[model samples]
Target: MNIDSMIDESRIDDMMENELIGFISTDMSDEEVLAFIDELEAEEDAREELFDHFAN
Candidate 1:
């Protein structure tokens, strides 16, 4: 999936609200979040199954 099109402020907010995702610090900025996504995407097996595991 295209991360740029797949995620946005609203989606991140929902993830945080539902505790579906976590951050090391509450002070994280949007840039940091995008960087994290980039890091994940760089991994060899960052597949839909992995994402589904987290979503569920």
Candidate 2:
């Protein structure tokens, strides 16, 4: 069998969707996100957008 056939794509998709929802809803706070971005040294525009996203 092919490697692709051995993987369950639907199950992976469901798990990824659930993780994204959890991450956006409750995993990280605004402060944490900002700290993370700071650690990464993200660009000004990207940081601004990310800050706005967490604010709302």
Candidate 3:
């Protein structure tokens, strides 16, 4: 079995869609939105690092 094929693209899509929906529905200022996005990026980076550590 291919490891790449085991990853669920649809789940990622759903998670991103949920985040976008939350962002659109909020009344945050531009700076706040930028900060929120940066936070999300940081969390995603951490998750990727953890996954890589376990994968290796």
Best by lDDT: 3
Ranking by lDDT: 3, 1, 2
Error of 2 at 39 (Å): 16
lDDT of 3 at 2: 62
Quote each prediction's TM-score. 0.34, 0.33, 0.67
Deviation (Å) of 26 in candidate 2: 9.6
Q: Over the stretch 1-56, how does candidate 1's per-residue lDDT look in tens digits? A: 55753674356446544542655355878888777766654541345456667777
Instruction: Give candidate 2's whole-model lDDT.
Output: 0.54
Off by over 4 Å in 3: 1-14, 23-26
RMSD of 1: 8.9
The reply for model 2, stretches above 4 Å from the true place, is 1-7, 25-56
Per-residue CA lDDT of candidate 2, range 1-56, in tens? 44653354445446555654555545689897566545444444455577558756
Of candidate 3, the 10-residue stretch with the lowest lDDT total is 5-14
Between prediction 2 and prediction 3, which has the larger lDDT?
A: 3
Question: Best by TM-score, which number?
Answer: 3
Q: Candidate 1, overall lDDT?
A: 0.56
**How high is the CA lDDT of each candidate model?**
0.56, 0.54, 0.68
The superposed Cα distance between candidate 1 and the true structure at residue 22, in angstroms, equals: 3.4
